[model samples]
Target: MRVVIVGAGEVGSNIAASLADSHDVVVVDVDPDRVEELNYSLDVLAIHGDGAAIETLEEADAGSADLLIASTDHDETNLATCGTSKVLGDAFTIARVKHVGFLRTWERSSGAFGVDFMVCSNLLTAEDIVQIIGLPAAVDVEWFANGLVQMAEFEIGPESHLVGQTVQEADQFDLLTFAAILRNGDVELPRGDSTLDAGDRIVVIGPPERVYQFATTASPNDAATDTENVFVVGGGEIGFQTARLLQERGIKPRLIEEDPDRAREVAETLSDTLVFQFDATDTEALERENFGAADTVVAALDSDQENLLVSLLAKRLGVNQTIAVVETGEYRDVFEAVGVDVAVNPRVVTAEEITRITREETTEKLTFIEDDRAEVIEVEVDEKSALAGEMIRESIPRLPKGVVVGAIAREQELVSPRGDTVIEVGDHVVLFVDERVAEEVTSSV
Candidate 1:
C-alpha cells in the first residue's frame, strides 16, 4: 500500500519506519536535513516540503496513496495537513493533535474534515500513564471500549500463591483469561499446561471489575510477602507522578528527594505522602529511612544512573521489589542487569503508542515476541472485513498466512474465540501473526 507520512520527527519517523517494512512509505518533512537523515537511515521515500501544503501532497502523489499520517508537533499543522491530505488523497487520513479537546470536538458534524482517525498524543500518553497509575498492580494496562475490557501485565513473584498453577487454573474466576506471557521481553502463547515461574511477566485480559479483582489479589504476592511501607527515590516529574499514583491507590509513598526546595514543594503538593529531603545517592540517608523494612522501592529520579543505583541499593537492602524509571533506551539492559523488577521509559512508551495509532491499518500494537517474528494485534472488523459475518473456523483458510485469531472483543466483553466463534461488525478481533504476514492479515480483514 502507498502511504504518505507528514513530519519526520521522532513520532513521525518511528511510524514511518514501522510501516515502511511492509508498505510503500513516503515521508515528508520541512527540514532538508531531517529528510536526508531519514533517507540515509531507512528505506523510505522522502519529500522535503511543507506537509500542510496541498502542493506538497500533490508532489508526493497523495491522491493515489492508501494512507496519510500527519504527525507534526503543532496540533493545528497536523490537523491542516490531514485536511489537505484528505482533499488530495481521499484516503485514510490520520492526524496527531496535541490538545485532547481537539480530538473531542473535531468531528462534531457529518461534513467535518474528512479525517478517518485522530490521535491525540497528550491524551494517549496521559492515558497510558493513568492506566498504570490506576492499576498499580500491573506494570502496564491497555483499555478497550471505554474501559470495559482491560489487558494487564503482572510479574510473578517467588512467594506468589498462584505460582504453581497454570493459566487455566488461576483464571478459573470465569471472567478473566491469560492472553500472553512476556518472558524476558518475549511473548509466549501459554497453554493450559504452562506453568508460571517467578519473574515472568504475564498478560491477562478480562472485564474491568474482574481485572481489578485479579490485580488486587495478585499484587500482594508480586509486590512482597506483605505490604507495609513504600519508598520512592527522586523528586522529578516522574517521581511525583509515580508517588501521586501510589498515594491515590492508598499505598502511602515516602519520597527521598535531593533538592530541599523541590522536595518541600512536592511535600506541599502531596501532603499525604512522606517527603524526606535527602540525597538518594546517599546510602546513609536511605538506610535512615528504614529502606530494608519497605516492601517495595521505586526509583524515579532524573538520572538513570541514580535510579539504577537506588534500585540496586533497595534490592540489596532487602526490599522485595524494585522499580526504576530509565530515560535512555540504551540503559534498559542495565536496569535488568541490576535486578530491577520494572524499568519504565516514558518516551519509549509514548513513542510506541503514537506510532501504533499513526500506522494503524486494521490492528493496534498487540504483543511483542522475543524473536521479533510474531505479534498480536487488535483489529476492528469493518463491514468489508473478510472475517466479518464468517464463522471463526470457516474464515481460517481465508486469513493471511502465519496469522490466527487469538481472542475477540465484542460488546465490551472478551471472548476466547474458537473456530465456531462468529465475528460481527465492529468487533475488535485479536490475532497472532508473524511479522511478515501482519500487513497481509490486516489488509485482508
Candidate 2:
C-alpha cells in the first residue's frame, strides 16, 4: 500500500515510520529541512511543499496512493490537506484534529471533510487520562475485544514488595495474565520462574475487574478502591473534557485555570465541577484549596512544561497520583522518570489510534507500549489461524518466542488463556507481542 502523510511533525513521522516498512510511504512537508531529514533517516520519500496545495499532491503522486493522512498541528491545515487529497485521489483519508466541534461535524457526515476517518487528539488524550486514572498505578490502559478484555501496564517502585517475587508467586489474580516485564529498557517474556525486579514495568491483560484488582497488588498504598477528589489544573479543551467525563462517571473534580475568563466559561459549562481562577504554579493558592487531599491530580495545561511543573507540584503536595498531558510524545519518558506517575501524550495517542485503523482486517485493536518496544493487539481467530481448534500449550510452538496470549473473548464470554485452554475459530485473542516478533506473530496467529 502507498501511504501519503502530510506534515512532518511527531504524529506524521510516527505514522510514517510504522508503515514505511510494509508499505510505500510518501511524506509531504512545508519545511525543507524536515523533508531532507526524513529522506536520509527513513525509507519514505519526503517531498518539500505545502501539503494542502494541489501542485504538491500532484508532485507526490497522491492520486494513486492507497492511504492519505493529514496530521499537521493546525486542525484547519489538516482538514484542508485531507480535502485537497480527496480532489486528487480516492484514498482512504484520515485527518487529525484537536477540536471536538470538527469531530462532531464529521460524525454527522463522516465524509464531510473528504476524510474517511477523523482523530480528535484532545478528546483522545483526555479519554486516555480518564481511563488511566480509573486504574490504580496504571501507566497505560487499553481495552480490546469490545471491552471484554483489558491490558494495562504497571510500574513496580523500588520499595514494592513484589520486587523479588517470581512470576508464579505474583500470579495471584485468577483471570489476569502476566504478559511481559519491561526491565531497564528491554522487553523480557514472563516465565513462571521469572523473578520480578525493582523498577520493572509489567504488562497484564485479563478481565477489567481482575486487572483493576491486580493494581492493588502492584501499588497497594496508592491504589484506592474509589477515585474521588480529582484535581484538574487546566481549563483547556482536554482538561474540560476530562472533567466532564469524570462528572459523567459521578466524580465532581476541582479544576484550576489561570485565565479567569476560561475558568468562568468552564464553570458555566460543567455544573458538577468546581472551577477556580488561579495559576497552578502558585503553591500558596494550591495549598489553601487542600490540594493534598486529592487522590488524583491531572495537569492538562496548555504547555507540556507547565503540565510537568503542575504534576511535580501535585506530587510534592502529597497527591497520590499525578497525570500530565505532554505535548511532545518524546518527552513522555522524561516526564515519567522525574516523578510524574503517568504522562499522556496527545500526539502518541492520536498516532496510535490512527495506526490501529491501518492494521489488517483480522486485527480488531492495537496499542503500543513505551512507544513500540512492545504491542498489545487483538485479532480474530479464523480457520487458517495457527492456534485455531488447538490448546494454547499445543500452539505455543507455532508462535514466536516473545508472544504471550493474554486473553480470549469467545462470543460474549471471557476465556482465560491457560495451558489447556482451547482456541476455537471466531475467538478474539488479545496478545502481547514484542516489537521484534510483531510481524511474524501477527502473521502466524
lDDT of each: 0.72, 0.90
lDDT of 1: 0.72
Model 1, 1-445: lDDT tens digits are 8889888876677677677787789999999999999999898999999998999999999999988888777878887887887777577887776665677787675424567777665444334544554343567677654555666777676666667877777776555667667676666667788887877777776677777777666665443243347787787766676677766767777888888899999999997789999777777877787887776677877688887888888878887667677766667667866577666655455446655664455665554333234555777888989999999879867766566565677886677666687899989876666667766777778
Say what the RMSD of model 2 is: 1.3
Candidate 2 lDDT tens digits, 1-445:
8999999899999999888888899999999999999999999999999999999999999999999999989999889988998898899999999999999999999599898999999999999999988576799998898888889999988767788999999999987999999987899888999999878999999999899888888888866646788999999999999999999989999999989899999999999999989988999999999997799999998898999989998988889899999987779899999999999989989989898889856487899987788889998999999989999998977777888899989998988789999999999999998888787787788
- Pairs of colliding residues, candidate 2: none
What TM-scores do the predictions have? Answer: 0.69, 0.97
CA lDDT, candidate 2, residue 171: 95
Superposed by TM-score, candidate 2 places the C-alpha of residue 53 at a distance from the truth, in angstroms, of 0.4
Residue 368's lDDT within candidate 1 is 38
